[model samples]
Target: MLRVENLSKNWKEFRLKEVSFKVGSGEYFIILGPSGAGKTLLLETIAGIFKPDLGRIFLEGRDITNEPPERRGIAYIPQNYGLFMHMTAYENIAFGLKLRKFQREKIREEVEKIAGILEISDLLGRNVKKLSGGEQQRVAIARALAVKPKILLLDEPFSNLDPNLKGRLMREMKNWRKELEFTAIHVTHSFEESIVLGDRVGILINGEMKQVGEIREVFSKPENEDVAKFLGHENILEGVADGRSLNINGIRIELPQKACGKIRIVIPPESILISKNPLVTSARNNFRAIIHGIEELGAIIKLKLSIGENLLSAYLTKASFVDMNLSEGEEVFISFKATSIHIFE
Candidate 1:
């Protein structure tokens, strides 16, 4: 297992504020955050490129906070793939082993084994600078694995590839992880990647570790409005609580718990229920609104609604959207269970 306790660092205008988290043995942990949230810096700290001003780092119960990158038993793949421009793919893949002073036969066998797994064996002789983005990524990962490091670090590995190629490489990475059974801490700003590739994920914003847990839980139930908005929750509204209920722009919603005064409300787009015709139901909060706009995505449709002076967003399946025959000017009723409406103090 890898553990970081109260890690802190300061660099110019950005600083990591007492950040801490852990990855279990053979677990895939994704550090999900936006650009400049210090994702790359955190990874560098783990790889021992930068020493933390505070706290400790432990790998398998051994403290390695002061170890150099070469002695940390961690393989880091940077965002740009960081392949040497002058070297061949094979040489890049074997560089770590050469530095470790491995025998020539051992190095060749290790390089070939990883290359075969990444399916870049044919490109091993090609100049790394001339290889395509996806090819370079494979070569970089192969090089990282050649050292058989205890932990693998990937920094936005797919950001440079086209969408289709990015998707294919993600699936291939999963296959490689399963085959190699290596512990990994992959960092990316993309939530879809976190859900698909991570066993668990941690949210970092402004260099602060806001929340960490199972990937689905962290996404569905964010800890606050900041995390909610960052996770793409379309509705993060300020409201006032009155013990039993919360009111926002004259829309009163029953609360799951009792509290008073200001609060932040988070309701995901999918949590909202919309219908062309009203029906009697047990749901607590319902409102009448006019469709302000409509956006058609592939599988889902986004509808913007004007609820009094406040605007709200909701999503509907394309089939259901077609069935409703919704239009911009159409009036509809939207409701959600009080349980789905989250209020944070």
Candidate 2:
């Protein structure tokens, strides 16, 4: 329901250069990028808070590039949960409707409905300052939704929330959007969030749109090295492809059938299997690699392995590590299925 074309904007230190993308009606589109990547600038530009140097923005086939923020029928929920501390949750949510000269009864009805949907009905009478971070965030979201905007632009709405609260909020958002058929563009730095919340994800880097596609497709086959690495492909190794096979540091691996070229192989650390011996299995690739180091990261253990001249990382459960009696300076065989190897040309 929204489209941006040739959008360009410049700031003191960062600039958006002809970035473009589209979101369909009722679709959950996420703009994912690292910090200082101009994600907020782009969102603000679309919201008409910052005028673009050059470009056009369309909503539902109508041009809104120069439309005023209020007239554009869009709601923006910023990262800081912008709520007026002086106002109570009910008043904050009713403010927009009041500004539009909506009737008092209508405003109350809308506010109550939104608060119920966001599960913040009891907190409505409390002042915004007294609410916890998650409560205030929910209030902000309720306020934004009360207006019934055509599109909702959320800039890291879950950034400040605890992991458990974030998960609950995400599920609530998904259910609310599905029921209301709301079109949303959420910007986030968390890959997990994008995968869970976005119907399609657009990866932005340095103001440039790198890749845009379904979550699984993008994760499975990233367009380039940067995108692959960004999506949690931590095990990167230089490899040469000969036909349908790849050779990396004296290890030969059969790949999915594709065009042949020198490529960099990206395998998720979790995909690598640690075995005590060369077990004949369905895995097409196996190699004997030395355990260079082992580090404990929370519940999982990261094993640094050296295969010939290549260094690779493997992630295993703590239980598995203990069961295998893994230690540094030990010999172990690494194995992975053919389909797990992602070859980027």
Candidate 3:
């Protein structure tokens, strides 16, 4: 396990504010935040590229706060892949082992093994600068794995790829993780990446660690409105809470817990189930809404609903939507369980 305690760094205008989190062995943890939120700085600190002004770093119960980057047993892959432009892929992969004074035959064997695993064996002889973006990524990963590091740190490594390629690489990352069984702390501003690759995620904003939890938990129930908005949460409604109900735009929504005074509620679009007819389920909230807008988003359809004075968004799979024949200006029944509601003051 890797543990970071009260890690803080002051770099110019940005600083990491007592950020702390832990990653279990072989667990993929993601640091999620927007641009300039100190995501890269945090990764660098953990990798020992930049020493934290305050904090302790422990890997498998061993304190390594003052260790140098080479001795930290951590591999960092920057956004640019950081491959030497003049060197071949094989040479890049062999650089670290050479520093460790591995025998020539041993380095070649280790390089070949990792390249085969990353499926870049065919490109090992080519110069890294000549390889495609995805190919370079593979080489970078192969080089990192060749060293057999205890932890891997990735810094927005997919930001430069197109959507389709980015998606393929994300899947490949899962496969690589399974085959290599390496611990990773991947930092990215993309929530989709976090959803696809992260076992747990920490939300960082304005150089502060806002929240950390399982993907579903953090995304569904954000710590505050800032985190909620950052996660692209829709249907954020402010209402008056009295007892076990909330009054929003004169619409009463049943609450699972008793609370009084002003409160904010977030209804995840996925949590709201839409049907042509009213659902006979145990959901506590149901509304007859008119579909004001329908957006075809490849595999998912986003429906803009008008429920009296409230405007809500709900997502449905393309197949289910096609089966229902939902369209703009059509009336549909939307139901969500009271427990699905995330209420905060």
TM-score winner between candidates 1 and 3: 1
TM-score of each: 0.95, 0.91, 0.91
lDDT of each: 0.91, 0.88, 0.93
Q: For residues 154-205, what per-residue lDDT tens digits would candidate 3 score against the true structure?
A: 9998998999999999999999999999999999999899999999999999
| Alpha-carbon shift of residue 212 in model 1 (angstroms) | 1.0
**Comparison by lDDT, 2 against 3, better one:** 3
- Pairs in steric clash, model 2: 1-24
Which segments of model 3 are wrong by more than 4 Å? 275-281, 318-332
Candidate 2's residue-wise lDDT over 28-124, tens digit each? 9999999888999999999999899998999999999989998999999999988988999999999889999998898998899888888899999
Model 3 compared with the native: what TM-score? 0.91
Q: What stretches of model 2 exceed 4 Å from their correct place?
A: 258-261
Q: Tell me the TM-score of model 2.
A: 0.91
RMSD of each: 1.5, 2.2, 2.2
- lDDT of candidate 1 over 1-345, digit per residue (tens): 899999999876667989999999999999999888998999999999999999899999999999998888999999998998899999999999999999999999999999999999999999998999999999999999999999999999999999999999999989999999999999999987998999999999999999999998999899877788898897887789999798888888787788799998887789889998784778887889899899988899999998888788999999999999999988999988888877766
**What is the lDDT for 181 in model 2?**
77
